[model samples]
Target chain A: MTSWMKKCLVVAASAAMTVGMTAIASADDVTLEFQQWWGVELPDGALQEIVDGFTQESGVAIELLSNPYADTKTQVAAGAATGTMADVVGLDGSWVYDFAKQEAIANLSELMEADGYDDSQLSDQIKYEGSTYMIPVVNFAYPLYVNLDILEEAGVEEIPTTWTEFMDACAKISENTDYAAYCIPLNTEAPNGIQNQFSSWLWASGGSLLKDGKPGLTDNELLANLVDYFKEMKENGYLSDGVEAMHEQDMVNEFENGRLAFMVDGISHLTTIKKESPDLNFTYAPMPKADDYDGKSGLDVACWGIGIAENCEHKEEAMAFIEYMMSPEVNAKLSQLANAFPGNSTAEPDYSENDELFLKAFEIFQDGYAINEFTGAPTAEDLMRSMNEQLILYFDGDTASVDDMLAATQEAWEAAYN
Target chain B: MNAKLKKKLTPYGYLLPTIILMMILLVIPIVMVIDYSLYDNVIANKNPVFVGLSNYAAVLKDSAFWTAVGHTLFFVIVSIAAHMIIGMVFALILNTRYLSTRTKGIFRAIYALPWMFTASVIAITWRMLLDPNGVLNYFILLFHLSPEKVTFLASRDIALQSVTLINIWSGYPFYMISILAGLQGISPDLYEAAALDGADAVHSFTGVTIPQLRPILISLIMLDFVWTLQQFALIWMTTGGGPVNATETVSTWIYKQGFTKFQYSMASTGAVILLIVCTIIGIFYVRHQKAEE
Candidate 1:
């Protein structure tokens, strides 16, 4: 070998060795607790397997603990006070206010900047107190999930195109079959998992959350009238027996059992139905409008979001972990689990990588059949959850008239606001 | 005495482990509850801000809190009375040897079914039976007893009573089982001796049977009273403390305030009031027992 060539080879070999060690030493190891409510539909710890790849790449260990449904908020509170909050936490979008009231969340603007989560992607509609506190995970729009098998079996060729036709169709389904037209769990929390669907109903019926682009939650003629119609629908056997106060899954189960023709519920439930009863033939449709702009008029959406706790000891690590979660590749891995549609627009693979019921949810989102007031005037949510609760009374025969229900509800709304 | 002292201490030593467990499990949570009760501890947020005795004062002034207390007390009084009366009556009938012990045992087992059933299932079962088109309504119509469906649980006046019926049904077997054990403890000779004196059923019940069963009855009634007072699930599951708050009990109200409304301060206030009411009742119970001693 020439002496000059040998010297060059020796220098290159030493440089390559130094570069390999530098790469090895730079990867820091850290563990993050990721808190969420674990449910049957969560797919046997599918999320853990999904996040594990991110840990492998980033060298950050993600320890997952599925908090119980009702106790999650309290557990998070305790976790925060003791400096034990999961660095990244999942919460029901509806619960954002209660958490925000306590400042249980880390100020996200700082973290979002470092994580490359910018404010421009979040609409002003979702901002709270002039700041966006949520990173949306699953954007759930309430829609009617019809057992197409039963609808077609009844010789019904078309889904109802309008609100009146929908009720008429329900009447036909009720008469022709043992199935009651719809199953509405009159006594459930957030009645039927999306009383937001009722808001969609109101929108279709010429009512809006507001007349203008503001929170017109109350003092709307059309909205109040929509409540009246909702009560009447309950009274007239449009909503079935043994349904009031039934849990959401039981409502879906009754549908799967072919006992109900229609079930109005969340978009996230697409995977739920497929896993729980794959044999059931169901199709999703936005609530039909009585007028052109009802559902199309405005949007109602709720999504589970993760926020950094305010006092996380490892704040930077938490932000890094959140940024990793939003990465296109990492989100794709989690999306493959089909627990939720990932927050990233570019991360659609987490949703579309599979060809199961998860595809159905994405299809609806693609069709623009979704809306959510993820953040709005605070009083709107309390009013919405409550009026739905009162809707149960109309089914129970506790009130002789819809006016009675509305008057009482208005009193409740006024009381809540007052 | 010194030897005896060590033997008694041995049982306490055995109890030491349980005491530690109770302190860790029950006492600590209770102490935390008391601590949280003194402040407004919003989950994961604001440091607990102590506003001493205000939660208690606020709960005292809130009419809804008082209404819940009234409903809870009403449930306890009515349920305990029904359980004691029905339980004592069942015990008296079964006390006789007209039926063999084996036959009596089968009957007891049959009646014991509801007690063994879960509270949630019991609530759901009763709700169905009481619904307008439910079994009870079907029977009522078939017999032409009432012109229309009662809608028993939907009516404000009827909802509390409807749940009380279920509560009585859920509770009687436990009381009967307890009083039956008390019944067996009474010497058969007392009944034989009473029979020799030609004491009729009523005469013996007022005299010998009642006196012998008094201690167990007191204890049983007190326990049932407390249980019924704390009752939430059955009423909540069935009626959701609704029909315009007629069935709203203190426990459900606390849950609604604390968890549903996120008003931990308000829930704490309600808790303090509930504790006070329970403590007052407990004092009366202890005094009653002391007088008997």
Candidate 2:
């Protein structure tokens, strides 16, 4: 070989090594992508505020990816298959168990312990088999949100706390007003929403959808009673005739428009209602119980939390962002901004700034959560979804008996679980 | 390389990228779907356990699957019938001899408006218009047609038909355009010749027009049926196969099993079944085309 050729080869190798090392060094500073579903629903710039606060504290640039709630599962599933999931993503409470069981999400028990964070800081609903997969960041209970003015027009003096009174009030509203007395979201597009709404009623009647971590609809007398009660209500025209097609959002819009006397909705819907109609007089009441029950409401709690993907390359940075967001101050601020219940135990929503009507609604949430029996099961969401599909027949004015519905539900559950 | 071998290899060299792309995009995924259909993977990211034909057996035995197939078939039959009947009417109207070419073009473009919009957009628009308090009910009330609002998409008896109506409205344009093209191709001399034979408008339509349009109608109907079976966004957005699974179709059921319930293997089994159905339809289409020739 010529001397000049050998010299050129050595020079080229040196340059290539230097560029490679520089590229590797540049990749050390991590950027974390955070995927969530709240962007469009949240107040303008609210997500950016949280992202900005986290980025300032952790110095990790966050790429916020907002997916619609309906498409989150599909996107996450696709991401998992492609090994391209975001570093951190917010997941619904129902997803925690499935994601963790499949190791799609990173188990954060060690990370939490190392950071001096315990389960108490977040809700226990996110734990699957006693392992933490997500840090609870927002939690809320479903309640019967009422348009107080509509009730007044119907000459109803107070919100109902028992099933008998609730039905009576609904009848009064129907007779006296142009509005539907109560709105039932029977939209099958979101079987989860329908299931959650129905569970509150089931629980209010002192029934549980799950018995021994499997579906228990067959022998659950209270559930049967609830179905019968719903049938009677539908017969009396207290529920909307359009219930079969209306989604939870549609019902929420009706409530805001004063066309619905009562709607079973989450606390976060308050933010949207307020934005749309600031003068609308609305209040939240404990979901009514069955006539024989001891007047205990069975409002179920749903939690929203953030989890790191199992393959996240920036786990430390993602954890830091989560820690910053879950701090009491930020958590409380986000909760207040979204009108949601704070997931952090130390943080409390400030309702003192609101008017009397708003205060009444906020106070019901402050009374604490109801019995949540389904959270412990790994397949709680699917099992309930199966039952919801069957129960919707009755809810949609199908002539199926309580026995038939229960049998169908039992069949569906066995199909899912077995 | 030898001249003969080089010449023979040139065509394949040009086709290599497309062949590889097809293998990667289509053939491999289909194989994977078939492989997955034989496994018992319910949870995401978990190693699938081999289960042979168990997934298929379970799906075939499940009543919900049959219900979904029934619903899907209902939707397909109703949608295709409407598309053809209405589309033929529109095509005949546009093909009228009295209409100017410019007027025909303008009317055709206007009739194709629904085709310009995405299925999701059409679904949402129709949903808003059909809401209980929406414009349709408002007009119905305005005319004192009914004392109460009609729950068009919400009622069990009507939800499937409501979705089918929407699909027909959205899909008929394609048939209209295709059939119109087919009508335009038929020589006007044949119509004049039929006229000289004393055949009236009705006879000409049933005899020459129908026979001439048979090939296009058959192809369009087959394609429309397959597409309707796969209709997801419209039903998903409108009724979500709801009011007691009244609108549930096979595609939406697969979505529920795969995305919502995380039963990947069961979903794959459903997909494989749909593939078999589509393949059968394709075979019929090919044989029908050959017979027509």
Candidate 3:
């Protein structure tokens, strides 16, 4: 062989060995695969920046596996089924019960105690069978969004605070204006519409959906009143049309385009509404309550919850990442970026520089206690869907009465719960 | 080994890879699903109990399952019938000698446009077009057809029909292309012979055209039946089997059971029921194909 060819071969072999060793060294470093829907929802690189910060501080890398919300649920469920779940996962609060029952997720209480984590600082932790399975990282409260232009055009002089006043305003808006007075998305495709928008009315009136941790629809007069209120809206043409096919995004779009006067929506949408419709004059208010109610209203809330998989190889590292996310400063930063409330009781997001509507919503949030009965409920989506179907029947006048509707829903929920 | 034995085994050896793939991908999963249907709380519970035929019994007794069956039948029948009619009409139009080659090409491209888009795009596009405040409503208002907007997808009365229509629109192109090929392959001599016999256009179509297209028609119907029976994405993205179970086909019901409700055993039971129906249709289809051959 020629001398120069022999030298070239030796140089290439050395380079290959060096690259292989580097790869092996990198492989040894703990890298957590964090699957979530937040990456697409947040500002580009915001989640990545948070993870990068953690990596820099803790010397543990995080691989973000992000998909859309529904897709994420499916992927995580599939992963759990196959015992291949990522080290860290973003959970919907509704999924906690099923995952815990299946033993797909680790008990966070044990992990926290082992790590000496301060559990008292956490605002909400999803529990199943007396064990913490997931911790909420951020919360998005559903508050009523009012369009000022629509109110003025409809000659509504005041924002409604009670059921009676709200009905009067809706009637005025329907009779005097081209736009609908209110919208309640009843789409069963993503049936959370029922949980978030529809049932919030009952909650806002200080009503309960559970009786001793069981379905209470049949005996709950407040639920009947809520159903009657919506039925009346449908009859008066005050409710937006085509709601049966409308998802949350559709509801948001209608409000953004000035076609809807009032809607209860997630606070996270404030940023999108501000950006998409810069000239939209809108304000946030607590969801209107029943005329006779004087108790503290329960505002509906959804959260970006986090959990560790039971199958995770690095439980300590996963817990560390969760702790990093829940730390006061980082939680506040995440809340601000996501336009949501911090899940840490001591962490307060600075809304001074955010959209004024966010600050208003935060004030409204403080006035009411956050409540979502579906969280940690078994087959929550199915329960919501059952109620949604009954509601649709009631609205269509196919069901005889609200009592019958509730009775049917109660039966369905009983079947599901058992 | 003997030379004759080796020769006899050559074809089986050639098919080994495909047989193994089918065993792994198709046969094994199907077997697992069937096994799951016989159990209670299969995937969601770590220790699933074998419940015999109870899941099947539960599904059969459920009113929702029957409603889904009715919806699926309506959706499949109407979709297949419309697809055949529309496909045959377009195929005949394109085959007519009156149109120039260039014009036929343009028309064919236009006719085939719906098939080019993905299900998601088709669903979103149709959703906007059929929305209450959408262009369709705008046109209806302009023409004073009705005093108010028509909620095409949201109305329980019309949601099933609307989704069926959308399915027909997206699916007819396949039928049209297949039938167009069948038309081109038919001997011109038959038509010429019919013309010489003083056969009118109607008679020629019935006697010559229909007979020649019979095989293709049967094939298209069988194939389209199977495809439409399993239709999920378009309906899911459009109405989600709603306005309250108006469009709740079996496929959507199975999806809700498994994915949304985490009732994997029930979902498997529903799926097994669907599979049995499809397997029956598939047998007929295979028989028809073999007869043609």
* Model 3 chain B worst lDDT window (10 residues): B39-48
Model 2 CA deviation exceeding 4 Å by range? A1-27, A81-83, A114-119, A123-125, A202-207, A211-221, A291-298, A348-358, A374-376, A395-404, A407-411, A414-418, B1-5, B42-45, B139-148, B284-293
Better of 1 and 2 by TM-score: 2
Candidate 1 runs further than 4 Å off? A1-31, A71-87, A114-127, A149-157, A188-194, A203-207, A210-215, A271-281, A292-300, A350-361, A374-382, A389-418, B1-61, B89-159, B243-246, B291-293
Model 1 CAPRI quality: incorrect
Native-contact recovery for every candidate? 0.14, 0.78, 0.87
DockQ-best of 1 and 3: 3
Q: What is the model-wide C-alpha lDDT for candidate 2? A: 0.80
Estimate the TM-score for candidate 1.
0.80
- Tell me, by lDDT, which candidate is best: 3
TM values, all candidates: 0.80, 0.91, 0.95
- Give the candidate order by descending DockQ: 3, 2, 1
Q: Residue by residue across B1-293, what tens digits does model 3's lDDT show?
A: 99999999999999999999999999999999999999997879889999999999999999999999999999999999999999999999999999999999999999999999999999999999999999999999999998989999999999999999999999999999999999999999998999999999999999998999999999899888889999999999999899899999999999999877888899999999999988998999999999989
lDDT accuracy of residue A394 in candidate 2: 59
Ten residues in sequence with the least summed lDDT for candidate 3 chain A: A348-357
Chain A TM-score of each candidate structure, as shown: 0.79, 0.89, 0.93
